[model samples]
Target: MTRPDVTLENYDDVYRFYLDHQQNRLLARAAYAALSARFRPRVRYADGARDRLRELLSSDTRLIVVANHLSDRDQYTLAATAWRTPLRRAVGRTRVLAKDELFVDPGLRRKIDMMGSIPVFRSKNHGLRAVADAGRRMMDVSAQRLHRGDVLAIFPEGTCNEGDPTRVQRINTGVGHIAVKARKLGTAPALLAIGISYGPDRSADVHVAAPVLELPGTPMDVTRLVTAELQGAVDHAVAAR
Candidate 1:
């Protein structure tokens, strides 16, 4: 049943209430599992990558998974892969920073909202104010969730690069800001660099590198390290393609 105040204007507040009320992390896990099962895309991983991610989760680490965005399906593919891990199950909720357009359509919007995505506004007219407002909101929500020990996933590239099939472009600085803010609040989680690859058939393959760099440091340093690691991972993935 939908809540009384569950309108688009109050979407975030209502959604947060639902997530807190349900308190059922398994619902998210099950949803992702179903998505994966139906898709049934073959998954390949670097040796011990899953294990290493699980280990990181075992620690009090709040992760900001930086991946090179390729397609709309990329997010779901990553969610499916993460769901396969007991680590994600243990971590509770995995929140994704998604574009505001995803919420334009009622059905897709509902699904994204249920999946714990924070809608961000990106303007083509170079509206800096809208972008900044969205960024601030995203950071605030991410910081709050990180405080609760939830893993936050973001595509630092800002948008999917369909033109560049070879490598990831330079990353946006928003990711670094979120990391630094989380640290200033007290518990600064490790920033994890996640590289996602898609085969020609659209099957998903993932490689998670070590924390490219630690947080509670300067935002520029974190952004630089994340960009380098993500670029390298995308290069590797493209080579395999």
Candidate 2:
């Protein structure tokens, strides 16, 4: 059944699930298992990505994993890919940043929360105080999570490109802001870019580019660096198509 009152205005149990940090590891494993069993995506890494991924996984620094969004099933495929790749060990601790609207779907919401997704409320809807404040709170907590060593996997483009799935859209500045804030507070994490290309045969191609380690200058500078790298990744991933 669909949940109608799951909005931030009436946050109830649905929205609460999004705010909760205690993720069920068993459920997460189960979700990944089910995803793999059902839809087997052929995940492939780019040159030197395998070795780099292993090194990144072994490190204690948090990872800000950014990827291109294509469909609703992107998250599932991401989790499954991580489980099969060198990131398998770190999947359980990663928090997937998802839109708050996804929580409105009772069925999907449960699976999203179980798989360790963090709800994000965008403030572009209306400029109301509450909405703006929620956005600020999201950024603050997200920064804190990174400082605490929790990996965040977010879609910088914000939404899926329905008009042209092959191309990556413009990135929002939120990700860069979070990274800069984290750097200022001391603990600096790696900005890793991931690209996904889905085939007609239900198989998916996954590529992980090298990580961005240097965080210099202002937030805009860091944001542009990450944005350009991610765009390059998306273009490279879909170049064959």
The model with the greatest TM-score is 2
**What C-alpha lDDT, on a 0 to 100 scale, does residue 47 get in candidate 1?**
63
Residue 134, candidate 2: C-alpha displacement in angstroms: 0.9
Clashes of 1: 0
Please, what are the lDDT tens digits per residue for candidate 2 over residues 94-196? 7888888877777877777677777776655444565665565666677777787778888888877787766778788888888877777787888888887
Model 2: CA > 4 A from native = 1-6, 10-20, 123-130
lDDT of 1 by residue, 195-220 (tens): 77777688766666656435548778
Give the per-residue Cα lDDT of candidate 2 at 234: 69
Question: What clash pairs does model 2 have?
Answer: none
Off by over 4 Å in 1: 1-24, 40-48, 90-92
Clashes of each: 0, 0
Candidate 2 C-alpha error for residue 43, in Å = 2.3
